[model samples]
Target: MEINTFRESNQFTYSWHAIGAGLLASFVGFASTFTLIVQALINAGATQQQAATGLMAVSIAMGLAGILLSFKYRMPVSVAWSTPGAALLLGLGVVKGGFSTTTGALIMAAFMLTLAGLWKPLSRAINKIPSGIANAMLAGIILNLCVAPVHALAAYPLYIAPVLIVWLIMLKIKRMLAIPAAAITTLAVIYFTAKVGNIHAGDIMPHFILVKPEFTFSGFISIAVPLFIVTMASQNIPGMAVLSVNGYKPDAAPLFTSTGVSSLFAAPFGGPAIGLAAITAAICAGEEAGADPGKRYWAGIVCGVAYLFYGLAAGAATRFISISPPVLIEAVAGLALMGALGNSLMNALSDKENRDATVITFLITIGGHAFFGIGGAFWGLVAGLAMTFFLRQRQLKAA
Candidate 1:
């Protein structure tokens, strides 16, 4: 009887841990990308309801896919809404279309992603990108995400100061829980200082607002293609690289295949593109989650469950954020990403041979310069690679 009781207790404990990890992972992942979606929706002239639906759709699809994939591989594989896609949506799609046009572009992008998945050779070839370049790309992408908090602090010094202090304290005292500490500190300050009515009552509750997709060749060429390229090059490639570097070795096909199928499933419901999340995946993969590689799967599971709750309560969730001060969100997000940004910079600049090239990539990416309708990340990589090749040729000739 005692043995039976112990077994049941142990089982419950394991389940609880898995659920906790999934929730944490989901919050981190969602926090990373949801802002871009909100901005995209507003830019696209989506009604509040439509925007909520889009957010929920992406969350649901990503959560379900992450859960399914992680369980299948018995490794934590987290799926996320594409931050790059959201940026593209904000930049291009918003100007061209409202909800209907954006949906059309989403469907088209998903279809293309699906086709890429089906072409196994192509997927494998893309996956063969050099680790240093892959890391440089990721560093370029996250550079701004980390600095946005400091920028936010300049905007709202009174509110963010306390939160920043608390964050630093947590970082010193409880390293694994630093993010949660910073988040808690920000929320607490907001709750105590901000008026209740200001925090809660202004925004309308988000609701389901479906926008049927309308196929447009022009929209596909301009919006969908660029969005897909950004999502794959900036998001998926690094996500796969993180997994590979860690030695878990989930099949690239299934990962991409799942993202494409899930995005298609989410299109009508207003989801943005779904893909593997490199930044959040790094968080889960780190020693903070667990030293054991197998145990890290729990982190992805935790993220999935949190995403499920966030998706189901998208209406309430959006309302909550709508009322909260933007400074709070910005500060918290910046603090959460700081560690990640530091790691990326360290890795990108570590090699003497790659230092110059990586610096060029970092500058172009961080400078936010766009050329020929292409974003910083894409152009930054091209410039860096070109410099790298040029320098290599020079060295070889001299030798």
Candidate 2:
């Protein structure tokens, strides 16, 4: 039934199904990527405390944003930490100015995102980016991380094999549960293989951490712009697509504006970047949430609420990650993202008009080359756009 009609029917029950769906999305997303989030923060020069705080901050930011947006708009508007942004941090290794500068970059990216919302031209320009190129860029950025399991297997086959076997079996049975199951298995494997001293059970409780941001020109150019691009093009755009597929066209500008503001609020506490969620969004925006689309917003709201609870345990999660083998963590994350990568590749090559340009974008992005401190993601887009524009001009001349 249509959303408005469902609203008219007054059948909205605070159903367990909706709540369960939300919780499931929350578990899958958080369990799958929280380790990566911590790893990214640490790599960017955050202290362990700062990394934990950042994870908590982003979780709360995304959770609150998701709840508010879904409740206000009466749609399943899910928000998430920028996974690509995390990957970008990982790829860049350590920034010169350390975590303080990285926080500054987060603030800058938030400001840019806010501008993208307030300025019609900026939003239009973002939309003007062809899907093929955007998808290719996302695929390229994540290519290395997705292949981590392969590398992990060669190094520690005994530990990784069981996890992989369970993940594959679960993928065949239930795709959503696949990553979470693997994550659980990974912890068990860590328990058996790693030294007992690695697991610091007492540090599981999280504490508030404050890190004052220090901005620099290099950080802005290298981190902020690319982050803004990835969050918008890769995360938020796909999130909107998920909503549209489930039949909802929200006012994008206001949503972006709200999320940007939330990110700003979170930056002081170490939040990296926030955007609409794509993968976990399907759980809340679909029939799994509710038969009635009007009621589906509750699922997103509950998911946000769940994130708040999860964020409360950020200290434990961070400590747990610290104990496990880093490669195993990367492998689990890579497995979770495999579905997204495959979909991106298919979309990137699907259109004959943009096929060549998309290939160029994908290749350059995966090459992992950077110039002037900027990453390959931006450069790949530049190359693909050049190819696309040249192809268009040639076509015009031919016609």
Q: Which candidate is the best by TM-score?
A: 2
Q: After superposition, how far is residue 199 of candidate 2 from its true place, in Å?
A: 5.0
For model 1, the stretches where C-alpha displacement exceeds 4 angstroms are 1-16, 27-47, 83-109, 128-138, 188-206, 211-249, 267-270, 277-303, 324-328, 392-399
- What is the per-residue lDDT of model 2 for residues 1-399, given as tens digits with 9 covering 90 to 100? 334223445544676778888998899889878877888888788877888899999999889999988878878888898888888787676777788888898899999888888887987898898889988987887788899899999888998999999998998999878888898898788877767575565676767787888888778877887788889987878888888888888878888888888889888888888989998899999889977677788888999999999999998777767777778788877886788788888889996799999999999988867787666777888899999999999999999
Q: Count clashing residue pairs per candidate.
A: 7, 1
lDDT of 1 at 212: 79
In model 2, which runs have C-alpha deviations exceeding 4 angstroms?
1-13, 196-202
lDDT (Cα atoms) of all candidates against the true structure: 0.68, 0.84
lDDT of candidate 1 over 1-399, digit per residue (tens): 001011222222234444455666666566544655765665566766677788888888888888787766666687888766765555443534467877887899898777778897756655544445545665666565566677778888887888778777877996656676666666567667655464333344545566877777656765676567667876787798887766666667778888999999877766788889886787665554665455566677678778877786666445555555764665565565566566766767776787788888777766655555445666666777788889999999999
Candidate 2 residue pairs in clash (backbone atoms < 3 Å): 204-316
Q: Give the TM-score of candidate 2.
A: 0.92
178: Cα error in model 1, Å:
2.6
User: 169, model 1: CA deviation in Å?
Assistant: 2.4
- TM-score of every model versus the real structure: 0.74, 0.92
Task: Output the worst ten-in-a-row residue range by lDDT, candidate 1.
Answer: 1-10
